[model samples]
Target: MPFYLEIIISVSLLTGGVFLLVGSYGLVRLPDIYMRLHSPTKASTLGITGVLIASMFFQSHLKGFLSIQELLITLFLFITAPVAANMIAKTALHHSNKPAEKTQNQALMDTIRDRESPPSNSIK
Candidate 1:
């Protein structure tokens, strides 16, 4: 392996590790469900993406050909993480879980309520 490739892999791994640590810390230390949900969904997605990129590069270097599995996993993770997070957040809202005291965003609250409530016009 060349020195540059090693450096790239090391940097990617280190960045991923750092983001994962931040996400885990946020999950443990954040005050409420909404705040806690952000770390794992956003930070961990980036973290996993970095690790996956490193894996892809490492595998390609070893095999002398590009690897598809890691790419697919990365794509899947990117697509699913946000959706899963949204669903979890909606579930929490449906159960009446409030955000932390310092968080006050009425527009977002109104949007969620609008989505949950029935349409104003209904056929009799």
Candidate 2:
């Protein structure tokens, strides 16, 4: 209920809101799925983290105890967002999703996609 606490909460909420907006904008404006994946995974992760941190602070200040649930959620989100992004990217690659014309490292992508098959004699 203190003035300083309100300022802290407001600042955190603003930061989170800004990051979330940026991430959403990036998702809509990016040219390709691979590029789009970076926004929600990275920017939105930080965005939600900021909001959760604000929640933790406000809850702790109000209740005189830290809320473990928000902490756990934050931890879980941090762990899973990148992993989910990785899986989605791999799926996109498996489906042969093409990058934008101006995308860099075209040869690297092709090389990864066209790597030589392992020998038939190799372990199954």
Which candidate number maximizes lDDT?
2
Clashing pairs in 2: none
Report the Cα lDDT for candidate 1. 0.88
Looking at model 1, how many pairs of residues clash? 0
TM-score quality measure for candidate 2: 0.89
Q: Write the per-residue lDDT of candidate 2 for residues 39-93, one digit (tens) a residue.
A: 9998998899889989988999989987777889989998999999999987887
User: Model 1 TM-score?
Assistant: 0.86
Candidate 2 residue 36 Cα shift, in angstroms, is 0.2
TM-score for each prediction?
Answer: 0.86, 0.89
Error of 2 at 71 (Å): 1.8
Evaluate all candidate structures by whole-model CA lDDT and list the values in order.
Answer: 0.88, 0.90
- What ranges in model 2 sit over 4 Å off? 116-124
For model 1 the local lDDT of residue 53 reads 90
Best by TM-score: 2
